[model samples]
Target: MLCSDLVAHYGLKKSRRVSIQESLGIFLLYLAYGCGNRLVQEFFNHYGEIIHRHFHKVLDVVVNLSKDIIKPNANFNETIPEHILNNPRYYPYFKDCIGAIDRTHVKAYVPQRYQIKYIGRKNYVTQNIMVACDFNMCFTFAWAGWEGSAHDTKIFNEARRRREVKCPLPADGKFYLVDAEYPNKKGYLAPYRGSNIRYHIPDFRRGQTRAVREPKGFKK
Candidate 1:
């Protein structure tokens, strides 16, 4: 059904030699099987070299369509959902929290000269992607395509400036959770420098069998 909808929307008419359905099938198979172009050619033997050309065209159509399909639901005025407000672990402190923000590195390929810009401390080429997700595990914002060597704070500042992924300032005493990598500014809350709980979790797990003790005066 989705494939048919894409065909209609993109006006991907069937060619004299190969039908639209078959062309789409070749593209999906390459993705689903994680196979190379040669392997895909082997699978669709009848289409032969034609699959190679059609593959990129269909891929381009899908990439263009994804801009609308894969964006955050930017509803700033919406109140905290009832489900999050009722949860014991999140009720009081995080009741005002809208979401969590973090960055991760994803492997990427680039030209030799440009590869140096994408290389991070991990000694690999990657794209540093910033993602914001709510308690419901749904993404509220994403800022991607930054160089892997870029700092998280720098990326966050740029995203805010460009309004590319507009993270609305929290109103009515609400806020968003972020790690120490970000500044403890107006709408964003970060953990304390020396007493961050994440730092203690690994050490706590190494020696403990029973309930782990909280770090001195660590607040929930």
Candidate 2:
């Protein structure tokens, strides 16, 4: 399992009071349930400091894993994906396509002075995370730590400039499918922008109906 891999490679050791499994469990619970150290302490019968320390220790290693685990396939340059080659619908047109790219907001709690920069369209504090993934649902690249208010195009532009995570670049004629928010550049594909055409079915239904008893010309 991943916990065992962490022990073997990442330098996380077994504690005197608990094994690596238990310490990792405490951290996972804190994240999964969004509970505090006190709640984890009550469940695991460990001190708050121990809980906090173990959580950070696990986090440190997991972040490091991104360098290896979240990157383009080693064979990406040499061969086309089987998913595209076998599917007649995408075989010819998308043969040069590599993967999909997008961004999302991850909830964040920053210092009060910096909170304004973290407020997203959802009106919540978050960090905008950009990612690219293959058709197999495997993440090929990830770029994180941007403020939530940052635009997707802006984040991608900056992420591509950084050397460490600047990979998964399209080779020659290859491209990755991105949404309308990203530019349809040399190595990226995006749909045409049209205000009259709704991308999703739900978007077309939005604001098209009202209560039958309401006045005909009522706005809002």
Candidate 3:
């Protein structure tokens, strides 16, 4: 049975001017609508300054939690994981593969004056977030705040070059798996391109008959 209580005990203390749920709602609405503080103020019935302060207050809590939640594994530098070593299909071929890198778009809120730059190919405001993770699905590094219009390749290049981002680079012989959209380079391994290559998982699903002359890719 689910508890239907709305004012139930919450971990966060309510501010003098707002309850915990209200504060969270203010932040979430700002994110969901991608609207300015002034616009959010109208919906929440609070002054823009109060809304801005609470919005950032909630954001600070999230930022502090990310310090631990978004870090790499403690033994990240250890030898190749045993699961990979024991898997016959992945062992030798993927011995040097370390992790995976990708990008995602997150809805973003900006002042109306600067919203023009945030519009993306998706036809909405967003932030392009570049991230990398190990096989265990643990995030190792993330570089965000790029305009939604930015291409994945452009964000990747900037993330790698920015010292403050500390975007981890592969060691001498190791590489990170990346999608086809990313460039295939020394440390980033993107699938072999060309229409002949059948890399999409649907192409290899069970019961799908393979034609003898069909182009083969990583799953050949």
The whole-model lDDT of each prediction reads: 0.74, 0.82, 0.75
Over 4 Å off in model 3, which ranges?
Answer: 1-48, 64-68, 202-220
Candidate 1 — which residues are off by over 4 angstroms?
7-23, 45-67, 71-77, 164-172, 195-197, 200-204, 207-220
Clashes of each: 0, 0, 0
Error of 2 at 169 (Å): 1.5
Residue 209 C-alpha lDDT in model 3: 36
Candidate 2 has an lDDT of: 0.82
For all the candidates, what are their Cα RMSDs to the real structure? 6.0, 7.2, 8.0
What is candidate 3's lDDT per residue for 12-130, written digit by digit as tens?
Answer: 45678897778888878977888887789888899988898888877766554454467666555556866678899899888888789988888887889877788888788999888
**TM-score of every model?**
0.71, 0.80, 0.67
> Per-residue lDDT tens digits of candidate 1, residues 163-187?
5445455676778888667877888
The per-residue C-alpha lDDT of model 1 at residue 42 equals 78
Ranking by lDDT: 2, 3, 1
Alpha carbon deviation, residue 49, candidate 1 (Å): 8.7
Weakest 10 consecutive residues, lDDT, candidate 3? 1-10
Q: Which residue segments of model 2 deviate by more than 4 Å?
A: 14-19, 204-220
- Once all C-alphas are superposed, what RMSD does model 1 give against the true structure? 6.0
The lDDT, on a scale of 0 to 1, for candidate 1 is: 0.74
Report the CA-based lDDT of candidate 3 relative to the real structure: 0.75
